[model samples]
Target: MRDAKTLFDRLGGKDSIEAVVTEFYHRMLADESVAHHFEDTDIAAQRAHQTQFLSAVAGGPVEYSGSDMETAHKGMGITDAEFDATADHLDAALREFDVPKKERTDVLAAVASYREDIVEADSTDN
Candidate 1:
């Protein structure tokens, strides 16, 4: 299996990642619903953290020893609808970056793999 670093390198590494992320956030912030979540937060720090997180996830040299996703997002009050909209923004960014469809799928799959860790449902009993 190709490691994330190798795959990321093929996708153009940090520069490309930053480009996509910037575009993703730009689009996200423009959307009223998504913007609300970030209203009180420092978007700069959020952007930096996201970059570091993605770098580590992509197997780059960066180390993201940050808080676990669940804890980090636990009280954010993020609904499934919000999550999906964020994902759509990401997809749009990838498309704008001209990422190949297969690569886009792989990246999105990686993002999806973290769903359980990032999402908090109202009831675990369901």
Candidate 2:
């Protein structure tokens, strides 16, 4: 049995979530390995969706209206290495926002749980 406080609450609620997600975009944009994925994308909208999605998953009141992970990542040709690199940025973002160690680890672990849903198979491998 876990404590009653939600990750969202421990994370300082909606405002903190927005701030962290914004910082996450900053980290992602500066990363050469994953920057291209966002080149033509609408960043504001993307961040909004991300904030909402992260909120929903973290036990907040917002509902996420974004595309499913597989569909959203389709044709992106995302590799495992790139995905891991992106996850690293996420961890850094959470740390930069001063999320607790256990919460940060748990957050990334939850994100990593979607590895298969987000990673596309490389056709060139075969």
Candidate 3:
């Protein structure tokens, strides 16, 4: 039996990953529910960080250089609905890139696994 190809490989490697990441951020920035999160952020830096982050998560050669998910999102008051909306943008981006269903499912699942770390509801504040 042979080992399955890594998602990175299935995703058409670095150049394709960069394209996906770029388009993903464009979609994200256009999504009102999540666009606020990147309001003051540098799009170039965010794209670079996210490209590396996705590359690492997809089992590529690069390691993610960003802060840990929880530390990075702390106090941001992200909610479950916002998270789902963000994922929806990512899904649309992948579809725009013509990514196959199985690979997109894997990518979405990997990102969704971090929901606990990324979502921080501020119930007490309200």
- The deviation in Å at residue 78 for candidate 2 is 0.7
Best of the two (1, 3) by lDDT: 3
Q: In terms of TM-score, which candidate is strongest?
A: 3
> Could you give candidate 3's per-residue lDDT for residues 68-108 as a string of tens digits?
99999998999888888888888888899999999999999
Candidate 1 Cα deviation (angstroms), residue 56: 1.4
Off by over 4 Å in 2: 1-3, 122-126
The clash count for each model shown is: 0, 0, 0
Off by over 4 Å in 1: 1-5, 122-126
If ranked by TM-score, best first, what sequence of candidates would result? 3, 2, 1
- Model 2, 41-117: lDDT tens digits are 99999998988888888878788788888888988888888888888888888999888899898778878888898
Between candidates 1 and 2, the one scoring higher on lDDT is 2
Selected candidate, larger TM-score, 2 vs 3: 3
Clashing pairs in 3: none
* Model 1 clashing-pair count: 0
TM-score of 3: 0.92
Candidate 1, residue 74: Cα displacement in angstroms equals: 1.0
- lDDT of candidate 1 over 1-126, digit per residue (tens): 754446577668888888888888899899997798788888878888887777677667788988988888887766677777888898899899898898787777877887877767543322
Could you list the CA RMSD of all candidates, in the order they appear? 3.5, 2.6, 2.2
